[model samples]
Target: MRLSVWRIKYTQRSCSFLRSFHRSFAAAAAAGDDGKGCGPGVSLSDLRRAPACSGPLPALKPTDSHTVLIRTDLLRPGKAPEPHPSPDQLQDRWDDTHVKLPCSEHNLFPTDRTTDQRPSKALSVFLQGLQGSEAQHMFGELLSAMAQLALRAPRLLTQPIPLLRTQRCRSITLSQEQVSCLLANAFFCTFPQRNSHQTEFSNYPDINFSRLFEGSSQTKQEKLKTLLCYFRRVTQQRPTGLITYTRQCLQRLPSWSSSEKQFGKLHISCEGSIEDQGYGMLQVDFANRFVGGGVTGSGLVQEEIRFLINPELIVARLFTEALNDNECLIVTGAEQFSRYSGYSDSFRWEGDHDDQTPRDEWQRRCTEIVAIDALHYSQFLEQFRPENMSRELNKAFCGFVRPGVQPENLSAVATGNWGCGAFGGDKRLKAVLQMMAAAEAERDLMYFTFGDADLVKDCVHVSRLFLVGSVFRLLLQYYECVCKKTTRSRPQKTLYSFLSELL
Candidate 1:
């Protein structure tokens, strides 16, 4: 069966279940107060860039011990490729912990019944698009450029990529050309051990492109077009900057009960998106613990959409492990290559995007992305537990806090209703949690409600009226009151209503 068919069925069933769950909560709250009371004058415009924060970008040099650089020579512009290494030297570049390259002699591409040792149908179609005068006009001899890309793969990928193992901080930095080459190999379905059901790298997300080509939905077709467009553009003129993926792990969780941080400046809006309006700021990825969350399959949400447009972010799945409670992945310098519209079931690729974001001093794009997965609750009330709330607070702080950087040097965080959709999170509760995290991290925040007018008003009002500690205490009290109720006859107050009535 086609993956999209299964996805549609699964989504329908999920929506049915969610509707029932929502009705239960509604019934419980039917007799409660509306909680529409507003605090002293606060409007959306007043929050826009109020007390903006800016500072020098942190110095980001590649460290030898914890960092791996694929194609080190490519770091400098106009530098020629290094001489091809001997077999022994090549062996030194690989290890059991790193990605096993498809071009390696022991791990060459396998012959299949369909293509018979040639490129697969998907790759053939992509390459065929590079032919003829029209293709030449747009991509500037892309066929030849692809041939050169193939020639440079083995040489450029001499170093083994280290897996960003849990509890260890490590980084992988590669040039744009190197990223393109690796993705080309992935497009050809050349990564070994990635497609098998039981493999040594089962813990990692799938890096091969086989599943992407199997779905029969329009989502798959449009996704392929977007990826092909990325290849065509990059082959036309290779990007010159570097992109870094850093896995950060926090050793100590914050004491939320005693922390005295106040709410930071917030810019709330019902317009624009994180990618469009939050440019140059640290953007949040509402991720799955597995990372890249179903982009390889039919799952299309915030993380998948972001990966489809900027595709370089997808490459992180090659080495990144599943995120832990106190860990997050930070990606710097990925350039957006495609424009897209709608979302999930209604998603459509809207052709090319010319990324004009400036590069930093380290020759990386100024765009920064942080991937943090929120806890998935089976029951809606489960998230209100004190432990789960603390877990989420730490997870957000793990992504937001800049350990080595000074408070004034942190960039404003760009985020929205993170984990509120499929994960069944409450928008008002999550907004307050993120606000507290950003405040503790000493960074300003830009909250995009994605056209939720009520959320904008509620967040603005509450933020204006309370400090971080006050909100934290109130949430604890609210959770206790809700969880202790034993009778269905009693009316239940929502978190926002509880906060409103008291404060």
Candidate 2:
């Protein structure tokens, strides 16, 4: 056959090619630069004197305009400060006096910062670039704002919350104006850096602003325009309304042995983004343990892209330590500046986003978000392990819990496909886990499956059954009745099919 002849010819040609490659490699190894054969030829002194190995490495130029002084705590070499309450314990230290500080720290920055001392080398570099831009008039003003913020409340940058101590999450209300100032600081790459790698400042990996100014790419240009718009808006007249940033982390892990679960009254739905529908309640940011992940560096995905659109969240990098599995970060008042189409690498900033959320009594916008990091499964099925499930359950319970007698005060949870995209988690499994956690916390659930239509119908069915009994009891009922009936009469049913049977 023609196939047999072609196969013989292909094998013969490949063998000949390999032999030729081997001969070339052997010849190259045998011939030394000194014309010697397969023997050591060059002396250390000769190598040092050679043309290629003769010069000192280029030195970094020091800035002449200002003295660079980076904060010591920001450079804390290893492990983020010991997690508060020692990770295993719970603490409720919230009181009226702790809420005294108004959210907007704009007064922390002044309009005139002409002093010679610069807080960081990064800030100095940023100033140099600002001089060439059309927005030069706002440079001195922005610097003054940065100096006022950094100098007046040096403690804000220095004294991070010692530990994850509070039982109930607290909200820090910041004005749109204050957010603009802080964002402008982050935009210019003012934050201190340990190095380019994620080794040293692991908790703050995406803290620098270097990547924003690196290339002339369209994404970079659009991002720049968005920040420019924010700066211009704030300069014209500082936005009057306030935005809130809430810090959420577990005070203690939830009980796994408890048989009595509280499946409280709830309203659940599945649809578009949590940001668009869950605007008034607490939205979930499926985040990284390091908080911002690589938003300020190279990453551009779920949470990282969110940070890009709302640059104010980048400030959280300055203070948030590395998170424990049970910990989560929450920000309430971040205003989205740019609207984009597509996901990750295909992401394109379409136009400006107008945030019209009304402010509360404290002047903070109704834009609460709880940043919970889901487990990433490299092997896919690893997420099904009992221990991993327990960890996620505790994490979500801590986030959903509201410490108060009144149920009406607690906000419902809005989330979906938490670790399903880049993390490779099963969509069905994560949705079930979120539901179980919400059920235990007695909070309503709102899921956005990111356009998975089938999940919407399945979630509706599962939610109805979930409302009938405790999470465990419902599971027991399904196993006892649903499984028994299905296995004897028909083929083994899938998890979704079994759960939907209860409806």
Candidate 3:
């Protein structure tokens, strides 16, 4: 009798949730359906760039490389789209603008092939592997879609260019169509060569979709399903909303020797992910030196999973230099399109996520994240060196500081156990390092332990000690002692222990 009652209640709750979802879905469909020029096809030909012409423009000429246009109406109901320009003709080049049209082809595309234009031999292996698979047809269609969209407006790929000729940070707002176009390039492995073990491209993060097409594992299939889901959603609805990408860099490194005790606010939570809880604030990605790290290679961790869901972030590697220990990368306005459960090897894409976060003045979602790479200690005891700790403090400081922004308006950093899992960093030490850096930067922090109860208690106790008067001064002095080899004992100690003794 009790089981029957429970079943009835569960069914009612499920039905209620589904009804609410249906209402929201219907409202979206209705809003998009209204004939206020919100049709499926965009005005491509009419979007031509204003001419510097005296009379009339010449018609586009046929090129050696064929032009492929993929239309939504052209897709057969049950069959996959046909492939275009055989993989052999791809003849990949780094600087060779992937989109080649008659008018813009010669003017926009670089004529002299430089060293950067050298082709990737590894790409040939991956491309050939996709010969008869479902991925091949899908990839060809995506590439065609990208080419067709870019031909409409050249600025989509040209402006806010990926080279980063200037060192200054830039923030660009892109429509969902623009994002799809960029992601389609990624899907086709059009980016420069990225080999994990090769030293030439080691500094830059892996940005291509090669890995997904390289392996035949179950994981590859699962990842492909999630990616296809995103493609279908964007292609079908054509989101009008905008997303921003802000590239933040620290031009001036903070001084570690300063004893100024500026106390920033902090929040410690035992459960939740940095992405889920840190939606509006600047979330931290325990990243690799090469931004996206092994996300496109063989990696699957906090950083990689973050990239998989917000794939637009992977584009940063094109412009960002390899991160030094004293540097960090901040990305703003990336929308989370999918959600997954589990961490690392256990990660599984659950489904689509509705990013309800409000937009900023720039029409981007108010989501910001900083990618900071912590030092990976191969040996357990190597991280204790005072110099290493100092390096971490500087790295965190670079990430926390919001340039030119007023102190009161700053968003608190959302982070926790940054390098504990993959990098073998001591969790307590990392927490302390982040707190100190935040204090120096005059920003608050929200630390997520991801369901570690013991850490919850430890954080509370340690943070209390950290907030006390003279804690900063004493900590610096202790660091000096360790560096000078002047400590009373050679025994290993927790940061809390050293602070407790001082107290």
Candidate 4:
């Protein structure tokens, strides 16, 4: 017997293919055939009953041994300053535990080419802008605020921030003011061992603003405007809310075969975006393993665009280590600051976004973002291997599962065709995998298809037709039949058609 291998390329026809299956299923259901091997579908109204995931914020104080809260008392104005403030006061006391402060003495600013002065051309550009006509009125006030932040860096960030390394479940919570001071130092390129040539922090995402300032592109300029706007706003009025970053590691993997979880309610749509429509839900960041993936450089996509709108998310790079398979980073209280239009190459910074996202019990913004990187495939067919599928299943489970929170308390996940774009993932397969994971985690899902109405209709049909275990079993069969040894080529049928026929 010969098995036919399929190379799954993302194309428009896939949507039509799913539509065909959907039509067939609907016809069978209408004919009173009992929709054999599938269950009654879920409705949008039923799914809405599951409350949006909110509340139960992490304790205001670091209640556990693994959590660290950066104390903010010293940040108060008129607080006694630390004695003997040497010129090298802000210098890095480098070690395994602490983030190397950008304002450190050893981290010299690149001298300007014209005058060989400190504060490289990039930093000078922004500093000069503070004095330019547009900001001339507030120049003195802004300059004083920035100076105060620079002077207080060493005193505020006194505790050694533990690096969120692999397999360690730890959290760091800091006041938004502390975040501002740290970002100010980044704007000045004061962070050490973060240049393109430097490898000291190679495993971590770049945090300094140098990369964002060096290149010249319309997108780059727009990004700078957004970031600069954030700085301006913070300087004028400091934020009092706190933000928390938790690195969660799953110790035991779920047994996908034996799980009997049913699919949760789904709210599928093709019109609105996850950020806008999925507000107050567990927003999913289709992330890169490095976390902030290319936001500091020339890349812009779902993850980067999200980071730009919510610059506070960028600070996660300072301490978050590269994510391992079983690990994910959950961020709560990072406020959004910008709203934009377009995507990737066409991305433009539209203007300021006033984040009125209400605060939780801990005085942190009621925003929760989960970062889970999908596996990138060189060849599209490589994703069909059972191991790869299992990895994806576990990865989504790690992101969706809330350990201490009861199933009823879990917030619904807002996601789209995760890993389907540049990663060349099959939207149909990924949607099923995510639904299954969300089901096992016992949470509803809000799926955004960007603009694929056919996908919206097809997924709604699938959610209505099948149970989680049935779909899981069918997917296993798909791996067994389609992924067996054979020549690699495009398949005549999609996973949708295969399941449709089987059911």
* Model 3 quality (TM-score): 0.67
Q: What local lDDT score does residue 79 receive in model 1, on the 0 to 100 scale? A: 38
Could you report the Cα RMSD, in angstroms, for every candidate shown?
10.8, 25.6, 19.0, 7.2
Error of 1 at 153 (Å): 1.7
Off by over 4 Å in 4: 1-59, 63-66, 70-93, 103-132, 135-148, 196-200, 485-488
Per-candidate TM-score against the hidden true structure: 0.81, 0.62, 0.67, 0.82
Winner of 1 and 2 under TM-score: 1
Of candidates 4 and 2, the better by TM-score: 4
Candidate 3, residues 194-292, lDDT tens digits: the string is: 434453454455555666566555455556556655765666565544444445556676555444454455567777788886665678888887888
The CA-based lDDT of model 3 is what?
0.58
Q: Rank all candidate structures by their lDDT, best first, as comma-separated numbers.
A: 1, 4, 3, 2
- Shift of residue 47 alpha carbon in model 4, Å: 4.6
Cα lDDT of model 4 by residue, 139-212, tens digit: 56665677678567876675556788889888887777777777777665556666643465778888776677
Tens digits of per-residue lDDT, candidate 1, 279-327, equal: 8788999998888998877888899999989999989988888899999
Residue pairs of candidate 2 with colliding backbone atoms: 84-163, 84-164, 103-173
Deviation from native of the Cα of residue 34 in model 1, angstroms: 29
Q: After superposition, how far is residue 464 of candidate 1 from its true place, in Å?
A: 1.8
Tell me the whole-model lDDT of each prediction, alpha carbons only.
Answer: 0.74, 0.53, 0.58, 0.72
